[model samples]
Target: MTVLVSGGSKCGKSRYAEDIISKSGIDKKYYIATMQPFGEEAHLAIERHRKMREGKGFLTLEQYTDIEKAEISLQSAVLIECMGNLCANEMFSDSAVEDPVSKIVSGIKKLSERAGLLVIVTNEVFSDGIEYESGTMEYIKAMGEINSRISAFADVVTECVYGIPVAVKGDV
Candidate 1:
């Protein structure tokens, strides 16, 4: 089973995803962190997440790109977080992904197949209705498509608002 949890930044989607996976009764939990901590802010965010999962028995893997390349077995419950960063990382890398949406979706599909329960956390970026430069716009468009595709593939899709989860696709 795959679950897509999406919302704006700091909306509690990550915490909700943690709760869901912990309750899944899968025993083994893996937190597939995709963010590459580059500076103080990023490092702080990573620390906060680590604190959140401190007591949880999750084996954290920093698979920043090419998630399928990670050697970890996926039978355990897996949570792939913050797809927006992953998309941007792929878009800006030297081997820039021509079709980032397809690549991200493909990677998620491979992980989903092996994972007992796959939880994906992404951002709801389009609701703001703001225009941006071409590069930023391209990234946002790719994220829009990627989020849609993942939602369609997931068994459950949720949008977190003020720390509350509102189901968009399936039962919570």
Candidate 2:
């Protein structure tokens, strides 16, 4: 089953995703962390996430981009922490790829096929309605499009709002 869990920043979406995957009855759980710590805030956020999963039976694989090439590849259940970071990393990576969204979507599909359950956490990009620079707007557009595509691929789609999950598609 492919589950897409999405929400705004600090909305507890990751926790919800983790909970779902942990109870999936899959013996091997892999956390595919896609974030790259670039600053103090990001480092702290990474630490917080690490602490959150301290005791959990999650073998984390840091695959910033090109997930298909990850060493572990997949497991009984895989939780992709977030799509925002992966998309950004792919878009700005040294080996530039056209249509980063499509590339990542394909990677997600590959993971889904390889795992018994695939839980993906993504970010909500259009809520603010704030105008960004051209590059930022492009990124937002990609995220919106990618989220929709992932939703179609997912068996269950949910959005976390204020730490509460709002069922957007299918059931939890």
Q: Of the candidates shown, which would achieve the greatest TM-score relative to the real structure? A: 1
Every model: Cα RMSD to truth: 1.0, 1.3
Question: Residue 61, candidate 1: how far off, in angstroms?
Answer: 0.7
Misplaced by over 4 Å in model 2 are 72-75
The sequence of per-residue lDDT tens digits that candidate 2 reaches over residues 1-172 is 9999999989999999999987888888888899997899889988999999888888989999998765544458888988999998998879869879889888888888988889999999887989999999999999998899889878999999999999999986
Cα TM-score of candidate 2:
0.95
All candidates: TM-score = 0.96, 0.95
lDDT of 2 at 4: 96
Q: What is the lDDT of residue 104 in candidate 1?
A: 85
Instruction: For residue 48, give model 1's deviation from the true position in Å.
Output: 0.3
